[model samples]
Target: MTRPPAKAPAKTLAPVVLIDLAVLLLAGGGLAWLVLRAQATLPYHWDWSVLPQFLAYTAEDGSWRAGRILTGVAATVRLSLWAGALALVIGTCAGLMRVSQRLFWRLCGGAYVLFVRNTPPLVLIFLFSYFLSGQLISTLGLDAAVAGLPEAQRPLAEALFGPLRQMPGFLTAILTLALIEGAYMAEIVRAGVQSVEQGQWDAAYALGFSRRQTLIRVVLPQAFRRMLPPLTGQFVSTVKDSAIVSVISIPELTFQAQELVSATYRSFEVWTLVLVLYLALNLPCSLAARWLELRLQRSDRGA
Candidate 1:
């Protein structure tokens, strides 16, 4: 038998989309006009001469890729990666604890969530920097070992220390971002785990699976799929939050931007460049997360 003919796709246009585009264009034009007018009225013009110099090298500050900019970017990326990893570990444990039968585990998880949620992130950073971190560093003695490395290993030493030498400056920044992010991630994880049908747990138990086996084989895999989108979002947030470390002089992007602005006295240019740099780092990740989310959703629907 011959197959039936396929129907043609209907042609349609949404008026709302056109209206939105027109409004956006009008607003953009207005903003551009305002900026031009403001620039013309300025008492001093920006020296375009420094633009080429900035684009080339910042030799005066002894940095070829502009003073501290690459260092700041590296530091930000390092801190973000480290903090995200730490947050995942912490959040998973806390999430598991929140759902546990043990009172102590539940209480510990609850306390962490409440404390982190109630505290402002900046204050948390400060607390870690000045108070908790000293105790932690003393307890760990990690700094002493770092400082005790031999002269032969000084290159290795400096390479490691270049990003995080401060007693608690780097540690505090990492911990602060991790702690704050972990609270949100804990909730995401808890919800993902709980979203798995109770029937799965019962079936695993009926099959004589141990608690660990059941969690590892059945619950966690499903939970992880559900958790990926939120986790991706949290990762992006962590990158942005690394900027807050500048307040404590951890030498991340925002701090370096401030240094540039102070030295060049070009606040607008410095800030705009910093904004673009952050967007460059973050926008692609956000896009990837959205794409992954859509892909997972489609798979879920098909399943």
Candidate 2:
């Protein structure tokens, strides 16, 4: 007979920790008191009045549209979507190469993962922007192409990637984010693939499936299911990590936040609102990841 899972420790799932509830409350209250005292002493003028203006404004065309804050949010979502998709593609390919039988492929994958994961993202962005993207954009005349894009397509293009003028910088950010995220996602994919039973592999081989066919048809399906939780976590991570590209002035949330602070001198207010916006964007992703993890756990128990 199989052994049953041990009962979880009551403390682990307990809603309230009565053991130190008073101490916890006292500490929390003390922190809040300290913050209120500091704010009182600070010379900063907190103007929340300008916040609504930044959230929505009337354009020169007399059409009401999103202001800097919402525009930044849109830019962030667009950057994350494009970068995350490319990262998934790069990660899947590199991850499969990691588990390949061929020595050369394994070496290539290892080198890629080693190089990217070891390098700091700040360094990666600067290096890629100056060395790679600059060359490609200038050589391909992407700016001219963007500028020459028909007016009919301009609205869609702007919606997807901000203004045409910003396209070169935006593309660079997308490339860098995808490359950085891909290295980590590769390991997730590898671990998920390896989680499958060796017996399953042997059974597939017994049925005359080629290596590629087995991986594609059988292993991938199960592995992808297992990968869903971590994949969603990585997707969240990508959205958060997109903030790092602000150094390159890609006009994502952080960059726009900086711009607003400069214009309004409401550092605390701007950053607090940014915190809220980031929470709004990432909280759903986190909840979805949690649900996926729980679902996977339930499936495992059933199996």
Candidate 3:
């Protein structure tokens, strides 16, 4: 006898995903409308002669290249990359210290995190830029050393600083971003480390593993895997936070965009360009984080 026809599996549609997509599209369309409306509502007619020049950032005379916007974007990326690296190192150490058995170590780690986390990040950025960096460079004679460097060595300095020859400003911005991000990253690392079972430690110890060996061989490997998602998100946050350094005239995207608007008096046009620039840089990173999370999940499941 022939079997009855088998039914195909039903595809379940997730309502939450549809809702999220609707919200995102609505927000995007609303923002676009607002930008266009603002551009139309400008009080006076903007001179269209400079519009092409501003957009192109080059003049026929080969003298008026307004490439500071590009420079600012590059500077922002550099700051974020350095800060993210520093924060990862600092946060990992602090997190380990926080969970250590020694009371003094824990206290020190706790104090650092508490102070950084409790204070506003912007205040920290301002204080460090003006006060701490000012003192350090002066007291350490770093400025003098850089100034007194051989003419031949100036290229090395330039490579490190780019056009920013000022020692205090760049270092202050980097350290400030790192310090603020590190506090949050420390908690992330601590939680990831602690999430592993205590029995795993006991097993490693029984296998004659030293504390360091246990961490390297077993604990850290697992902890790192668990931390990847949040770590990726933190990296994107670092990129976004680098824009805050613009407050110090660090020549980041927002700063240059503001300058462009001041010069052109086309606030909407300048801001729209900057908004697109940021989306270009950040959207890829956000997508990368999502991809990494999925790959990691698949790897975890396979193992």
Candidate 4:
């Protein structure tokens, strides 16, 4: 005998979805009201047409080249990528030191986190730009070396380092961002490491694994799974913080936006476009992190 038709799963809106929709609607309404109020009070005229030219333009050869805003975005992405990699290295070392059995290592790690975490990022940027970068560059003779490179090799050198004139400023920004982000990343790494069960450590020890072997083969693997979400968050934070480098004239997105505003006197439109650009960068990251977290949780449950 044929079975009766199977029932379809019920379709229902999630509470979180409902809440998000409500929040978005309210935010849109509020923004509309604010814009209307500003239009009545301010003498400013909004011309969005000029904004596209700042993002891209056709060169004399008819090939499209990145304009001011796109150039700024590229710079920001490059800075964030370099800074994030450096921060990961610093964070991992500091995290391992924080969890080390050696007294000196622990003290060193603690001191780094304490000092960096306590300091404001802006102050660090200025201090590094003025003092650390200049001394380090001059002592290393980086400027002279770059200046002496052959024409063919200069492009490679600039790609490896940065623009010749802005090398010090760029390096200072990267170092400052890495160190600041490293402190927060250190704590996240530390927590992830410690979250591993004590039973796992005991089991590894019983199985004749050395301290190093157990951490490398056992603890870190599990800790990394847990660390993915927070690590993704820290990377996003690095992207946002890279904007601070613009204060020292690193020519990142915010800096380019500022230049555009000065030239066009279209502060509101320019800033709104920049705000959306940041959201474009960050929203994907946030969604991906959530998806990864959920997938990991499901795998754990299935296992």
Q: Which residue pairs in model 1 clash with each other?
A: none
- State which candidate has the highest TM-score: 4
Candidate 3: residue 83 Cα off by (Å):
1.0
For candidate 2, lDDT tens digit of each residue in 1-303?
999999987666344566478779899999999878878998977777888877898889999998889989999999999999999999999999999999999999889999999999999999999965679888888888999999999999998888888999999999989999999999999998899888878999999998899899889988988899789989999999999999988888899899999987899888988999999999998898788778878988999
Which segments of model 4 are wrong by more than 4 Å? 1-24, 150-162
TM-score of each candidate? 0.83, 0.86, 0.83, 0.88
> Which TM-score value belongs to model 3?
0.83
Candidate 3 global CA lDDT score: 0.82
Better of 2 and 3 by TM-score: 2
For model 1 the TM-score comes to 0.83
lDDT of 4 by residue, 129-177 (tens): 7876778878888767767878998787577655777776777788889
Better of 1 and 3 by lDDT: 3
- Give model 3's clash tally: 0
User: Model 1 scores what on Cα lDDT?
Assistant: 0.81
Q: Which portions of model 2 miss their true places by more than 4 Å?
A: 1-31, 59-63, 295-303
Given candidate 3, what's the lDDT at residue 84? Answer: 94
Summarize candidate 3's per-residue lDDT along 266-288 as a digit string, tens digits: 77566667778878888888888
Error of 3 at 48 (Å): 8.7
The lDDT of each candidate is 0.81, 0.91, 0.82, 0.89
Local error of candidate 2 at residue 53 (angstroms): 1.8
What shift in Å separates residue 43 of candidate 1 from its native position after superposition?
Answer: 5.1
